[model samples]
Target: MTGFRVLFRAACSRVEGTGHLRRCLTLARELVARGASVGVVTEDNPLARSLAFSSANLSVHFVAPGCLFADLIDDVAVVVIDMPKTDEQLSLHPDWIGQLRQADRAGVSVVSLGHVSASADCFRAVIDLYPSRTVHAVNYLEGPEYLILRPEFAASDIADGAFSDQCEANRVLVSMGGSDPQDLTGTAIKALIDTGVTMSVDLVIGSGYCGDLQAWQTQATAAGLELTVHRDLGANDMARLMRQSTLALVAFGTTAYELMALGRVAAAFTHYSWQEASAQRFESLGAIRYLGCAESVLSCRRIAEQVRQLLADRDAMAAMAKKGQALVDGRGACRVADLLQTYAQETRDRQLDLLYVVAHPGDELMGAGATLIRQIDEGLRVGLVVLGEGSASRWNEPGPSQDRELAQRGLKTALQQVADQLGLSAWYYYRFEDNRFDGHDRLDLVKVVESVIRRHCPHTVYTHHPADLNIDHRLCFEAVITATRPQPECPVTTVYSIETPSSTDWGSVLGHGVFQPNWFESVAATLERKLALLELYQSELRDDPHPRSLAAVADQARYWGRRIGVPCAEAFVLQRHLAATISEQKHSERQGES
Candidate 1:
């Protein structure tokens, strides 16, 4: 999980618009903040290049136009598609289907932002930011809550307290998205003129706007409407203008969501069927007033009347603003980042070779720490799971709650350091009561162990011996046994029981079965490193005469080494190992019958 990577593939141009690439940049910043290395792949266009240059930390790769999704899946864990559902983009590469199959076969996860035409099933996840009422797929993440708006729109210092009915609202903000491919900005201006209301109009246009601005200015002057045109404003300046406006007249896109996040009531117009679907959903939430589709000639009149009604009735505007602000919290990027990180970690954990389950803090170090280090050095991926709090046993009565919390925090920090030093692929620490394993039901421990076993899917597992004097150690052994019970789906094929020094030594005196070792691993090179790591748990070590002491641990290593004819070794009793020859034996039987 050290180099978790994500690559975003999006399209941008005069026709496709720049919203897809811009939103990907916003989400990329959030992923980088969470320690993910992010890159963006988009068409080599002027607008995309300018926007990409603004985000300095992100690695941007420019591809030829209409070939944005071709040959871009490199050493990344996940590929996010933010392209439109246009017919031209979909038909650009005939081998798009085969490319997706190859990525799947190579263990790469593909996620989509918005619907891809005729290929929804090819994606691992479809994040529809503007979804309709019916659920599309089980993996489809929907609604305005997942809208990826810039963080500036959700700042704390901008106060949108209440709309005042006493003061007549005059300012109106108009933006027709990055590219008004259908010239909806002209329709919005005509609608504003038809409203016959005296208000200051602030028109915002993006880099892709190709309309006749001079003609629009002439018409506004003739209509006696006060108009100020702002071109290509950045996020901070746009947010500043949004804060000053009482209402927004916008096309259906990222601007609509930004208006909702800022509580600026907006009446939306749509050019595409998908945009209309999103508008209807937002209108149903009382966030925006959806004027019917802009494709119809009469929709202009509809927008005109709605603008008149909204300007006249301040109470309705207040209600709409409150609902819109409450609907979007502007943290969708963070949620999406969390989803990608989880998938990346799971992808990494599936390659694990060994997992060690223990009962307490220093138990792993005392038992098979040297062996764990040796296997990891030989390029075997290893993980660790601690099942108890490792501290509450020090208290006589139920200890002060705050003191226990502090001790638990310290132990977690120490485990993090140990995992880093040992280069473990994954590690988890759970807090079952320290020495109270007997008080809990046996099934509960089995379920927890089973859950971890299913996630990591290690080929070999190591746990405490069943004959240990400690109650937690005995229960831990039982849990691992039941969790790894032989089934066709279980990845575990071998299980070994390692001896903890003090607990295993005292078990024989109390009439419990002694640990008889049948497997010994040479740890001549890693024994010193294991002893160094034990210093992290100094509170758990004792004097020279005790079996848990540092000198006594080295002496025990020598004793096990002498028995196995090695300089140093760790001994284990191999309880179970399901040999991997069943498939071979079945093949031989079928050949003989033939």
Candidate 2:
């Protein structure tokens, strides 16, 4: 019941090819496996119908060609579209752009699978599966790492296929994709025959293949090559055949990525100009050899020469397998599913007023407990993110004990209890090891924080002061600052760094890491609640004179409160404040004058 519904609006036809539908199905299956309700909306084509019938629990709705079923999209959390962003292609579905915009306006996330002609603002993300050397915009998730392939194609260990020179039959897999308009399967078979090498050929044809399969078989047999023509095989069977084969000759499409995922060397031929461009990118990566368009008379000879060259070198073949597998790890469907699910959840969640980034579960309360309670009392939606588990640092041994899991569960329970007590709108926890913040790449921490910031879009952020004695606190501060940079897309306008009890006081003893307070919030009313909340973190609390103890916490609050002429107060360092723009300030001034 917690899972949301995802709808795919795609096309699959003789002219459009089945790649869109196939990849969408792969992603849909992954999402469903992870507890999402998935549906596909496409033209009432035979391919779509057959796939829908074959895939158990998959819902496939049909619509007119070049039509988007806007009515079918009700109650859907996400809509994934796979269409080219070309003028001619956009003309095919006139209402697609408008429908997509309307869906986006309705708070439904729209994700583009490849290239889509819809306006950029309509899409929550553009996941480009094609290979690219250059960096894309932030919203576009490009390259082979995001390439969606069937789960069956995933391989754990890639063993190099022995290129047997003495073997009578060298296995060559030829697939021209669904509906090979240029008869590339036939072209590949003819090229294999021309290679003059005795081989066992597996001709995998698709449901959309309009070419004469009998002619391909006859030609292969006449040329003294073993031919096995497989028609519309299931993904598992196809993956099995691909694993058994030594090399694959495929058209530039989803199959190419699948072959790469299987760690099988491939040589690709393109049927379209865009496909040729994509093929060149693969060629550059050395994962697959590009043999150009199959329509040219010289293309067959080029394919024959490349096959001969690749089949002869065992080392080269092994290297290609490594590069291909490295490029495509077969978890693309999972990654795409993650993108869809994240966008869906982010769209569904309400924005937060303040987001506190801390190094541990209790760090938020330890630093700004009274201030946070005051904000919640004032009707502000507050959230918290703990970057580390704060468990590993407590262990005296080098490794963790069996009690670690139990301890983590207890910590989670305590976090939920704190959330319930503080009336927080949200609370997030990451499993970064406690006390090992310095061991991790700083950008990794930054990226995680950035993802959260982008999701919640909080206006104000509070994090640990950078000069704290704890390394995790310092790293958390750096990550929050970097993640909340003054970008036009970011919603954060102010950031404050709070002082932890022991870490900040101890860090100040080093002289260089002195704590300086520039802002103070009177917490006179919530002082008792802050002390009560400290009871939830009993493990983190200390006795009597320790800075983290209840008595010391109250003493520090009274100390800061006296400086600011209040009964109790929380102090903070104003780390960053993005002042209003001239236009914004003028607008505010005009309203104030009224």
* lDDT (Cα, tens digit) per residue for candidate 2, span 275-367: 666788677667788887855554677779989998888678778777778777778787678768766765676578899999988999987
Taking all chains together, the TM-score of candidate 2 against the true structure is: 0.63
lDDT of 1 by residue, 1-594 (tens): 359788898888777788899999998888888888888999898888888878888988999864645555778788887877622455677666567656655666677787643543345556677654333211344555578888888635356534444335579999988888878888889888999888889999887788998888899879989999998899999987877787888888888878777767788888676667778767876778987675666466778999999988888998988777776767677667766775577565455789999998889889799999988888998988887867777877875543543465567557757877898876666657778988888976787677557656798999999889999999999999999999988889999999899998788765768999999988889999999998888768899989999999998998999998989889999999987698877995798599
Stretches of model 1 off by over 4 angstroms after superposition: 69-72, 86-92, 116-122, 133-138, 155-157, 161-167, 351-594
Which 10-residue window of candidate 1 scores lowest in summed lDDT? 132-141
Native-vs-model 1 lDDT? 0.78
Once fitted onto the true fold, the runs of candidate 2 whose alpha carbons sit more than 4 angstroms away are 1-3, 85-88, 91-94, 116-118, 132-138, 157-169, 294-298, 354-594
Position 95, candidate 1: lDDT: 68
